[model samples]
Target: MRHPRLCAFLAWLYGNEATTGRILQQNQIIFPAIFWPAPENAPLDPDAVLGTFQSAPATSLPEVFELPGQTYLRNLQKISPGLWNGRTYCMKAFDLTEGRPTLTCSSGHFFDALVSCDLLEFELLSAFGEVMPEEEAFPEFCERLTLRGTLHALGNPLHHACGRSAAIGISTLIIFPAEGVYHVLLRSCGSRLAYLDKFFHTVPSLMMQPMLADERMEYSVRHNVYREYLEEVFGAVEGEMPYTPAQYHDIYADPAIQYLQNREAAGSARLLLSGVAMDLLKLRPEICTLLLIDDPDWWLTHRQRLRPVTMVDSRCGSAANLLERSPATPLYAIKLSPELELPTGLLCPERFTPPGAAALCLGLNQVRKLLLYI
Candidate 1:
């Protein structure tokens, strides 16, 4: 992204202090632990409005935390700084002048009111930086907004402000059979919704699911993936969530939840694309995450499938016969790639596809040259 404005902001945000806030790229956010309140009784984050209501109250929460236990980085304290050599991780705590947002989420509903607050120990995760030692940080920036244009009615100023600040949670899964290699599925989110088309760019990669109001546990990448995958693919199961990563895997291993390929990827596959694409593989520890699973099964033949898009040549092209695609269907980006096709047949659609679909598929692939990563 031509982050000229973000660069200007960062340049000013880190005008002083050599080691602290300096970022190679505008997307790389740094939060030194020293900046955090010692007892992490932080100021409320902007997410509190939507996040707090989505989860059970602090009073009802159990002492134990549930995480994807499959991750390699066992405990944050147990691992060393050296382990983050190739990927990003929670590097070290430094100090940063926190931005005390004027608003905080109410933790009750998606459209709930934003409360006036300053301290964010509860939600503002501005204290530590998920540092990637290897790659250059090309950041992604966004502001949460409700795009109700000017003629919209607003009687209460607070309602207008909170509605304007409602957060949009954009979560993606870089499904890969092996490290650095991604499995992009073709998702047919419909030619209808303006929102889905913009975010997925009509043709997109990665599994996209927005956070529901009830998913109140603090945002964890692995858990987000696990929870979204199960609900989106398998439909929700009633029970306590698996507390350990292995338990999470056991559910995945179920024949019913067959999400992975039958076997591990045979060898490293390579691909070449003609657009602006770079693989930013930021390992755990670096991102705002609890490295949930050490390793996850990728070649999922999950039978409970979304209706595959109407492949151009497929005889079953009637409108009534097809299903509107889910965000997970962006796998078409992979089908378009000549180099990275897997050995499996179900994964690739016929090459001679529809021109309209082909155009979107290609356009999204072009954008991905800049956005694909784990």
Candidate 2:
């Protein structure tokens, strides 16, 4: 399907077809919360918790985290009861029953469990949940989250504050050659990093990033970006880097972050949005914002996560003016075949098939937009 991200998103929302009794069989556990300390400089609140928890260092990427195990996953698996009605498939439907996030969305009002987090569960699906199979569960699930519709979703994407998934991410652009004003060096990352995404064949991505190790750390709006950068890119023995203070850009809190509701793609979007690109530039802005588009190899590697698909191939330069374009227009798509098809049009598809993931599905395009400077 053309809009593969949308397909994965819908499938993730649908979750596994488990019975209600089966899911609840798992022992209930407190949904863990690592309370971040409020700013020391800020005035104290009488209503706030008395004990102080250190705030995590701030970073440009979504903070990688984990939730309480099987209970959370089982709860997600059983969320799709009313096919098209009620709270439906939203992970937000789960509420904080003590620490264990419990399902409680009968009234259909937006749940408060999500918004009440320190770092926030940006997307809400189990990163470890079972993969979505090839068959289409809902008849027109893919068709609904169109590329234009996705762009519309992103531009106005709200209400997706928090949920039950770990934030995932990858690099989109990286500069190269060191000659031109901006040499775009899209590196095919080392195969060792393949687990971050599909590495069936080495991919020369425009960006580079290491997967989050899922370590324990305090969540903060500042301090952590460089710490993560130094850890991921430089592999520094000490916490410091060789770059002079002058060479670096100002480290600051992220003014905003985009959030979409679908659990799988929402976490996956972190991989796309919060890559080494952000922290790298903070090292000294030599590496510009990573240029990224959701193409086919991307679809193959990250088929499970649902999102918007742009469907930009050789014919269409951008989705900006595709208002009248047919939603089902055949994508002049390609795969890593014996004979590779060369790019010739404004947009072209040059992708290779990976080991596993969905065969075909509709997806969404987050943007024709490019280059997010840190």
Candidate 3:
């Protein structure tokens, strides 16, 4: 009721009671209950995952829906003032039309559309008593909303017109190949702007964005993944203000990055593209990937750099500090040997964010046959 435009949109997508019940029965985190797995024989290497940037005229909400959407967003900001409306990449299209997976993205911002999507999810959950909708009542509720068939026009999960902000998130599963241990982060309740107390990838998942103004028109999934790895895994912090191209160059040049790059080049490390999917709750697109370091010596040499903590340090200043603070603490590692399975205790929805759980599940699905050789 609070976000009628969003309600209208959702009604178009899942207004049928049966559809709502089916998605609920499938998975609490992601829709279709499973990721749309990457095609077999699709290029798994990062460099091979092609992306292009298009400068298109920005899209706006219909005039009839604009006021209510803006009101909802303002209310959300009032509730969470720290929400930052930074520039982010919005996926305009994704497909394998070019003989390999390619993402067509454009410039956008956080506040333009994503926060509104969050608002919609908030409203839906609120209607269900601040929880996931009951299977029986949810569909009935959706069926009641006015549907304009907007979402149905958006095509399949792989292709669609961009929303106000179709922010594409990149989530990578990090594995220490020798030990067969893959890491995951437990977001501290005292920290994180969103998804607090949820589990994410060991290396914090990042929405693709240009760190410096000079790079605004460019987008690279590999580069985005590497930057998060440097910050979260190596605690490499970038200084504030007037960022330079050199700063980013140095970041990419870090020995740790170089080490991984060399291993990837040497066939000892792999960066596989798992696939992409939209979070069921938020409708945010996410790119799933798997990074495996298959060298015993690399882990042996750098394992000490991984600082694990049971709790966030009380004096932490920024969300970045929370991520850089403990690379592996407050985390879980699913073993790769004998096939990967999350620990029994972590099999519930509450333990992980939808995108994180989807990445792990989809990444494992992409890598399962390969694990047979391991």
For model 1, residues 107-152, the per-residue Cα lDDT tens digits are: 2322111111101111111211232112233222211111121102
> Per-residue CA lDDT of candidate 2, range 1-374, in tens?
11243224433332232111111100221111111111223222211211122212222222222333223333433663321211211111222222221221111111211121211221221221233334453334334323213322332111121322111112222121111122211111222112232121111221111112222121221123233333222232331333334322322221111121122243332222211111100011001112223232333433233122223233443322332243332111222111221123212111211100000100001111222211
lDDT of each: 0.25, 0.21, 0.56
Order of the predicted models by TM-score, top scorer first: 3, 1, 2
Q: How accurate is candidate 2 locally (lDDT)?
A: 0.21
At residue 94, candidate 1 shows an lDDT of 18
The positional error of residue 229 in candidate 2, measured at the CA in angstroms, is: 3.6
Q: Estimate candidate 1's alpha-carbon lDDT, on a 0 to 1 scale.
A: 0.25
The local lDDT score (0 to 100) that residue 210 gets in candidate 1 is 25
